[model samples]
Target chain A: MAKTPDSPLRVIGTSVTLSSEVQSRIRADLGFAIEFDVLDGSACLRRGVTRPDSFDIYDQWFHSVDVLHTAGSIMPIEVDRIDRWHQMAPMYRGAGLASGAPGRRQCVGRDPADVLFVQADNGLGREPTHQVSMLPTVCNADGFAYRRELAANRSGPESWGWLLEQNWGARCMLSQDPASSVTEVAMAARSAGLVEIADCTNLTIEEIDALFVLLNRRRKAGHFTRTWPTHEESVRLMAQPSTGLGSLWSPAYFELCASGVDLVYATPIEGYRGWHSGLCLSAALESAMCDRAYAYLNWWLSGAPGAILARQGYYMSVTEPLRDVLTPAEWAYWYEGKPATTPLPGPDGRISVNIGDRRAGGSYQDRMSAISFWSTIMEESNYLQRKWLEFVG
Target chain B: MVPSSERRSSSSRKTSDPIAERGGGYLYAMIHDLLQDKIASGALPVGATLKEGTIAAHVGTSRAPVRRALRNLAKSGLIRAADGQGYIVGKGAAVPLSSRQLYDTLNGGIGAVDRTVSAERIVQIVHGAIVAVMPFGHYRILESELGEHFGVSRTVAREVLWRLMEQSYIHKDRKSHWIVPQLSARDIRETLQMRRALEPQALRLVAHGLPSAFLTDLASRIDAVLADFQAVTAPRIDAIEHDICHNLFEDLQNKRMLASIRRNQIPLVVPRIFRRNFPLRDDLAALRLYDRILSALVSGDVDAAARLLEIHLDRAEALMLARLRVLSVLPPPRTDTWLSAIH
Candidate 1:
């Protein structure tokens, strides 16, 4: 499967190496024979991380694409390939584009249109998996988990409010990821008249001080145990018989349940917190490898063995059938309704616990947003996380 | 948003270490690797206690070298802090060597169910988990780790961290990376001033928009207080006062207004305030003022409600300041060394 001796395909990825999950998927499924080098983190930061005119593909996240694209680090996918490419959902098609940059477009609704002009003068095929500054990837969403026994222990919205009203204080295990999930939880709690967020933006010194006073009161009364916990502790306590509820991302929640806990994920009455990201080819690569990169992408999304392997690496895939892949227990607990807790809320504001999207009776855009939001969240989560640490640590 | 370049002085200068000079780029990898090891091997242990001095000593390095390491640890879910204590190893410390697919499987499963765990219970669980991990007589774990062990969500976590900071339980750099905060009378005084500003304001609002249901609830609560005062076998007078005051003021219905007031006042005062012996004098005055306010509200005298509100707030401020004055005289750590960036 090596490239013809006369022509070679080269790829330079930021943060991903030849040994990475995505690369292995490409190697295994697409069977592309090419030289792939992963630029170190510092290399990307130092600028000109790759040799000029050395490679054909430059893979990066959608959020980070701005600088690279502007610097002509990579070229867009060829135009002819866009129509032939697998279609993406419409929800995340144009997310995180620096508010108003021209040339960014949506293709197949699932992927962000990678602006060809950002890096090179070539049109590029857009994969709808996620909006990429460089390459394609799935997204993530924030979800809730609850103790079966606790929900059974109480009933109705009043009890639900009472549950959060319990004395543990900020000891609740929620991610500081800063995606909508955190705000959703706080907002929902506030809406239910249970908890309060000091201020969303521009919290003054006085507000911060007031939070401290309330925190001290709660601390003295043991309202919040300690503000923050490690993701691991958050996971463990969620599974254990400790607290009654937790808030986290779908992937993280999945990890906990796979560890053999009886916990279940719940969608609050509120909407899921969301974000998206993507993959792109580098401009510095040799011009000859563009087609092969497309072929590799197609093969990866075709649900072939390599793609399956890559999906297993924790990154969501656009290839596989989500329903068939999930176990019956998993399906019922996650996608289907888990009988033990609040049923997953439908995209409709109704209280249906059914996991599939009930929005106008289709699930495509919902699924795309689910993936795009995940990636965007992770990339943007750093600041929210820091802020959260400052708020409660 | 201060320009990133402009924001890079003073705190950034003094707070940054040689390791940080390597930048968030280099540090992330090293920290990630270190955390990967800690989470994988359970060397960090779920719910185990953490200490700056101990971590510094065990790693054979100074506090600066270990600061980035601890921040990285905290980021990865390997560690947290106990309130007024130190960091504790978190359950996430034991990250499994699963493929991302396995993680997906697990994460999907965890995400699917409706587990209703509260923040307090989560904290207790982590605290208990650490306690379980500790051997007999390791009080240092409780003292060192409780304040640092908070969940990862930025908003809520920041709240807890700020509290730890206000109480001199934890500290952070300009980028807001965290460390266990040291406590002193000075810190306590500043915290009191913060309490003075916010607490009374919260009380005032709770008075203004005194919901009908909350008022009924307060009536019963006051009756309970009167009952407690009358009961010959009453356990603690302060308990009744605490309950009456807490239930009357902590109503969720009034949270927005109260939170609004408190949010504006706490940070401005907390860094300068210090904690002292529970100020019985202030507490008594607060109790009497609350009683009068409750009476006025129950009597439907909006004017009395307004008057008592001002009195309550004024007394709280005066009492808190009196305490702060005494603490200011203590031979505390260099007060200027503690920046307002504790949040």
Candidate 2:
């Protein structure tokens, strides 16, 4: 039970968090060797709940908090222990941005209890408390990426409706996951005048049916050439000549750019799909393991990891800390959406952005403001999955 | 109306009945009891016309007492006033009375004609039907219809409604109609969370005090299921789930904890609903996990058993949530006849 410098800290997360830079930094800064169990989305959820003792830390999206809390698989972290707890963006602190516009309604709600904050009595509350179910980490607005040549031929503003355009034929790709893909396609269906879903996050049975029917029709018509299950595959697909456009993650967009692919990560007039990722502690952690878990969580807030993730186009929950960690030029290029003054390294420590290149959306706030919906496991997700599989087949 | 020839034939058939000598208040009470029995047994079909003179002639009673009896039946929602005339049996008039409902209505001690029904009994019948149909979506609970169906006064029906409101099961809508809110995913998760917290703790409290032989037997049953989980039938899985999650802790003698745990039993009812559309996949992992928990309990390691119980609950919650998501897309289940819609 005694603490040791070489004690292994088991971290369970998606492949995005297990990047070489992120893993190496945790080992270097936290002074403990890290063991990672990188998994896909469903596997991560299954392991997080059923095998709490198998890992010390979980880095995943906020949507999984309900499942983890319901399972009692995660213990609340003391906000006092997080080094930059107060330094987080005002949105996390119950304050809206300067524009007075709200964050994505799917994730953040008007009530403090609606978010991840946990009170001492083990109920979700909005006001700051000693305990939090999870610590918010890297987040960003995501949208589709398309080949420059394909966009040059199109007129007018870019739209999510374009994904369903017969013009794209079988050249377009889509994400294979149900949670995000369903929301993305629903937005596209609505924008394309195919269906009008009331709430993208909690789709009803009828809306799910209509959306899937539309998707299936397009699938049978050979509208989609392929589907990408991972960000790496998504990047590869978007970089190909055959793929005119597809649902793309920020990291994959950066990866595509690093490979010198001429692509435009669109700020679709309709809106960007938003998502946030965070860290949670396993409830099984006790004594020294709890201490090491806290150390790993605090290290995530210490600016270095945020900076690394920022290079991949993610906004750290606490951007102030990242301001010092990143160069002024890199900050202007990434957060301000200004042209890069000089070449900048991607998350993988390779030059992905050259001088005079600008982000697609004007600024981080502007992009976050236009979020149409966030990735979520909707109440209708099982229906979405079954239909999604049929479309895939 | 009863045909004239049939009425004359039925009058001769009634001579053996004991009610022929009953008079005054007893005569009307006897008629009411006889009619109640007829309705309960579906002798009177829904929407069947019941003319005052026809029933009076058939039963060898004056129209006065038969009139009073029909009025009582109307008040109870078993019969409604026909257009401009006599009464007709209501839609749910033929719904077989539950034994408990009957016991509550009947004077069990003396078998006397006391027809007073408690609010609690009415609440139980209505609550059972509401919980059954609520997973489908919003439903209107007609106060008048409910009163008639349960053979209670409006005041008595209001008492049942107020009790259901206290439990957060049903509420009055804008039009003053009682509505059962749609069962949302959040509601399911919240209930499951409470179950995960309370049920495992309940298990821990009873594990040490439980008979070792009983624990061993339960463990062996679970082990047999786990050994061949892929071939296990749905009912077998349900039996094991009920034993561990519910039946085992029934003897804890802690009513508050047990009651709270019982209130969270909605998830337990979901498997049967989903099995209607989808084949129940054999979840070997859950079976194995439950087996471990039972084995730990059998060995008297309460802490390990409680821990494993938590894990099993987590898995169950996930499975139930997934099942509900699929079930949500399907149309609502057929409404039982006992459930009447106001709007």
Question: What are the lDDT figures for the candidates, one per model?
Answer: 0.40, 0.71
Off by over 4 Å in 2: A1-6, A96-113, B1-267, B270-343
How would you encode candidate 2's per-residue C-alpha lDDT over A1-393 as one tens digit per residue? 554545688899986666788888888887767899888776787688667878889988776676566556788888888877877766776553222365533332112124567865454546666778878887777788888876767898888888888885337888876667777778888888889977766787789778877887887777786778667777777777878888888888888888888888888887777777789998877667777887888888888988888898888777777788999999999999899999999976789999999888868887777765677778755445555666776
Native A-B interface contacts kept, per candidate: 0.02, 0.10
The top-ranked prediction according to lDDT is 2
Count of backbone collisions in candidate 2 = 4
Angstrom error at residue A106, model 2 = 10
TM-score of 2: 0.56
TM-score on alpha carbons, each prediction: 0.35, 0.56
- In model 1, the Cα lDDT at residue A246 comes to 55
Top DockQ prediction, candidate number: 2
How much is the lDDT of residue A341 in candidate 1? Answer: 40
